[model samples]
Target: MFKRCFLTLVALSVFATVPASANGAVFDMGEQMIEISPIDGSDYYTGSANAQAQVQNTGGIQRTSFKQAIDSLEAAEVEIREEYAVYTQKYNEAKGRYDVAKAECKALKNNIKQINNRLKNVEKTKKMIFNNMPG
Candidate 1:
């Protein structure tokens, strides 16, 4: 139970850190209001006006072609597959070691039980011989 809880906490921590390392910072803008007003008293403007607009680029989005997107996804998939293979191999090796250790533990426990039984029999024999000796 302790091991299970520890592993769960570790998994949660790993998952939590993953999103924290994302590209952009998180902004919490609560209750925003925007109002646009024209300088003219009239509702509509008839004259042609020269307008210049400047946009601050925050590197939020990247425009990519379909082929580029596909290639990126394929590369990600290849990396995922390689990582999976490495982790799977490590898991298999650990499992093999665990199995060997479990078998050795079982054998050691059995040997201990046998030695305890022999000790009990030896004590009983000693008691019997003492009782049979002349008083």
Candidate 2:
């Protein structure tokens, strides 16, 4: 019962996250160069050859046909954040379940100990009775 309530609370919290800000920075591409908007907190993409050349020479940046590269990076960032949330929620639930199981096991161990103690006392009492009995 307690476990169910705890899980419900966790689920509600996880699903209740507010959507990310819609003002995601946009990327603009130019001939032989990539133009990224919101650069330095403004919405202008300078069309300079040196800048383009610099971006192009960089190995990974150069690989994609400009448009796909920016899109891929943006998608990866969003995915990373989303996957992190999912994995974290699952981990917390698993940890909670493990804790509950551990507690149950401890309780069982205590019960076993108590039973053993009672059995020992019974054996001692029986031995005393036999010792006191007339032959």
Candidate 3:
């Protein structure tokens, strides 16, 4: 039937792909990979690959350069973050000191007002005593 025909076609296809020799020795069906050329303007693998050696070297150089760029950027990011943290800490300390100083200034103003009121009272007492004691 149709099933037998399908099985026969599959068997034939498999046998066709299988390499054979006169002595029936099958060599490797090694890695079958496709090589895609680098696209223009892409950050990845770029450089004149006119020769096989150049193409191989381009791959290695591209990877190394890209890795170096990433490492440098990461180092810069870390430095910037550390500096930001230090600035934040300094700002917090300044804010705390400002608050303390503001509180001290308020307390001093209250103390000065109290001292002025006492001085006014003392001046009034002096005037009353002088008015009564005068001949």
Q: What is the C-alpha lDDT of each candidate?
A: 0.85, 0.81, 0.85
Q: lDDT tens digits, residues 18-80, model 1?
A: 778652343222213335455886887689878968776744444346667889999999999
> Better model by TM-score, 1 or 2?
1
Model 2, residue 67: what's the lDDT?
Answer: 67
Q: Give the poorly placed runs of model 1, Cα more than 4 Å off.
A: 1-64
Superposed by TM-score, candidate 1 places the C-alpha of residue 29 at a distance from the truth, in angstroms, of 40
Query: Over the stretch 1-135, how does candidate 3's per-residue lDDT look in tens digits?
Result: 999999999999878766444224422222224455666786777676776543354888889999999999999999999999999999999999999999999999999999999999999999999999959
The 10 consecutive residues of candidate 3 with the worst lDDT sum are 22-31
Q: Residue-wise lDDT of candidate 2 within 17-123, one digit each (tens)?
A: 53223223222224226654554835676666665434346665666658697899999999999999999999999999999999999999999999999999999
Off by over 4 Å in 3: 1-60, 132-134
